[model samples]
Target: MSKVTILGGSGAVGSIATETLASSGVFSEITVADINFAAARKLVGKLKGAKLSVAELDAENPHSIRRAIGGSAVVLNCVGPFYKHGPTIMKAVIEAGINYVDVCDDFDATEKLLAMDDKAKKAGVSALIGMGSSPGVANVLVRFCADSLLDQVEAVDIYHAHGGEKIEGAAVVKHRIHSMKVDIPMFLDGKFTTVNLFEDSGKALEEETEFKDVGTYSVYGYPHPETITLPKYLKGVKRVTNLGLVLPPAYAELIKGMVRLDITDEKPIEVQGHKVIPLEFAVAYILSQREKLMKEAGINQPMGCLKIVVKGYKDGGKNTYIFSMSSRGQGMGEGTGIPAAIGAILMGTGKITEKGVLPPEACVNPMDLL
Candidate 1:
């Protein structure tokens, strides 16, 4: 029985990925490894069968990462605040020479991870990055258009909206805060440029597009890795952009307000005779306000979509293809987790034999993912 290690298995995306991988029967043994064993045990308790086990892993510790994922056929890294943990855990995975999959959405980390392609190849590791919903399924959709739907792919625009998780984690909130604070990357006019999300660059490109079955919502600039990596693989494509939101427009604005006020600072400050990290405080406050904000906005359940627009010339005339992947009732657990789980399956089974770092568009077959 091959063992599958799910780091951060106790968290939002990891729990679902654990279930998805186990249900596939691809790996006979599944280890739910997290920093918190009790939380991992709590999640595993509700899951059936003997194929599942739990382990404690300190993702920040290289030795701990190796200990957690060592001997596993494929490691599905659902651990996030990808900006912090993504590269670290991936480095450990590469050193261990295990097949790897991760939902790494942060572009900066994506750049660092992709740069290790040669090392991954030397280690004979088949690594798939950003296999989550937006970057994951979204990349494959563009590949589908480039491969089958379009003669000349000129521009690809991606938009997504999700969130409304049952409980919001501090790491998740910090990731969102970090995304807005940084200079985001976008591909335009055949070159790459960085734009501040709160500045004119982000505002000018804001879009209001309807996601099939998920209603129309305003999506703003996102630093999702697709914008950076898609341009590399989809040659001749002149433009690529990722616009996104976390559902309940009210929630989006609320986070924006926090950013505008510079309340997301990671540096600790003295507050009422005590020390508190601004980002930490913001996360706790956001979690506290989430229920009321969600209630007010009528977001009772999780809903999300990956909407892609590919435009180009065909037969010497203008052409456009619109594709949408919308999900309601179920949320990130399925939308994001299942894809990462499938990526692990592919890597485990040797179906994806490309040795090196790769995005889904570059390695995964769209038909198989579909």
Candidate 2:
């Protein structure tokens, strides 16, 4: 039987990926594995094709992960806070000897996973990492430019914007908080470098980018894996950057405010009679005001855009290619989830023959994914 398991299958991106895989008719069996059994059941009920089953998976437990994904031909990992769970889950998946795909965007996690290339190769498992919006589609677009359009890729700039989703999870908020708290990695002037978004080095890279249907917004340096991974594959590329923002400027500002205030510490603090984790409180408060912030900003529906600009030499002359994927009703979930589903499908179908831990540009064909 062709079986595929989706870890954290009930989440924002995972649900979309589950839906896509269900409708694709690629797998005879699809398992929605998550920590929340009810959410998994609900997500399964909403899917149309594929015999769906729900399994409670405590990602922190390797045995739970193994049991949850056993017998699956492919595993699509959609668990969040990748910096926390990505490397761990990947190790488990690799040990299980299963072909794997994940939308892991954390640079540190990506680095960890990439280091497992030899392990995956030895196990004869094909693992595709960063198969999501920015790193997934963004990486594919740049590869397309290098292969089909440009002679020598000199620079690549990736930008994304989205928000107004119906539900915003704490993990999502925490990921954003974690992003701002770390050093942003970028490839500049033929060298790898890191910049702090709150500092001048990062602010100097910030600029207003106009996404096709998502409107113009100021994008700041993002520490996405693409900045680090793409440089290796895009040989000779002097500059690679990933910049993004969450919609409704106010909402983004609130997140920035919390980070700036230093209230995002993970350690619990006394707040009345009970101990409250500052980061937990910050995420809860940010999500609480999300609705009001969206309404105030006049954002009525989910919207997003992934814009990529590749500049290089075409026939020994300076040339540039710009591509944008945008939609008014769909936002980050679809943007990220669909590609993840596609990656799983490719792996399941044996379209991706490489046996190693690799990035999207290295494994996925732009045309095939598109």
Candidate 3:
């Protein structure tokens, strides 16, 4: 029996992923597991076909994760701010001996997950990490270029713009805050390098790019795993860069403002006799302003695009391929979640059989995923 468990299944991305996987009809049973039982139930209630169920899961607790995953053939982790729960959940899933997939976009998390490849191999588990939009589809597209279209792929540039979801969760905001504060790694000139988003190193690479159907916007260096993981797969590639922006430009600016003003500091500080983390206040305020900013931008609904630009040589001459996936009423949730579901579907169908922690490009076939 094909049973799949989705952790964080009620979340924006997880919900979409759950819908996609459940509707595929490949799984005999599907479990929607989330910390919020009501939310999980609500999500499951909306689905029509397949054996759908809900489980209360506290991802912070490995035991809870394992219980929710009980005997599922595959586990799809849709949890967010992956830096926090990624490695923890991965270890738990690996120990359980079930094949796993996750939309882990954090470069640090990817590095940590990849480090556990040996353990996953030892346990006979196939773990696919960064199976979301940028790292997932983006990676596969580049692999396609290298394998079929190009004689020698030299560079890859991945760009994404998404926002306008009904709600911007705190985990999402924390991830943005985390991205801005940390050193972003990018593969350049066949070597690895890091850039600080707030500094000139990052700004130097910023440019205005038009996303098909999603409008034109300025993009900036993002700390996505594609920059780190792609280099390992696309050998001899001189450069691989990932740049993205959340919609309404102002929304992104607000987060950047918080980072600049030091409002995102995690260290607890005194606030009128209370120990408060500035980051919590910053995230709350940013979310409170989301609706206003989105409305001001005339975005009444979710819209987004994922653009991948691959450049290289075809028959010893330079060639370029650009792939774009965009939607008017859907945004990051669909862009990221759908690919994750596809990865799980691949796992469930025996398409991905490698037994080790892996990135999308490492084990997934581009044609199969496409």
Between candidates 1 and 3, the one scoring higher on lDDT is: 3
Cα-based lDDT for every prediction: 0.88, 0.93, 0.92
For residues 158-206, could you state the per-residue lDDT of candidate 3 as single tens digits? 9999989987789999999998989999888789999988889998999
Give the per-residue lDDT of model 1 (tens digit) for 1-370.
5888999988888888888877887888889999889999988888875378888999899999998887798899999889999999999999999989999999999999999999999999999999998789999988988888778889999988886678678788888888898898999999999888889988988979888878888889998999999988888989999998998888878888999999988799999999999988888898889899989888888888888899987778778999887778877777888888888888887779899999999999998888
Indicate the TM-score of model 3. 0.98
RMSD of 2: 0.9
**Clash pairs (backbone) in predicted model 3:** none
Candidate 2 residue lDDT tens string, 266-352: 888887899999998899999999999999999999999999999999877999889999999998899999999999998998789
Highest lDDT model number: 2
Candidate 2 segments whose C-alpha is farther than 4 A from its true place: none
TM-score of each: 0.97, 0.99, 0.98
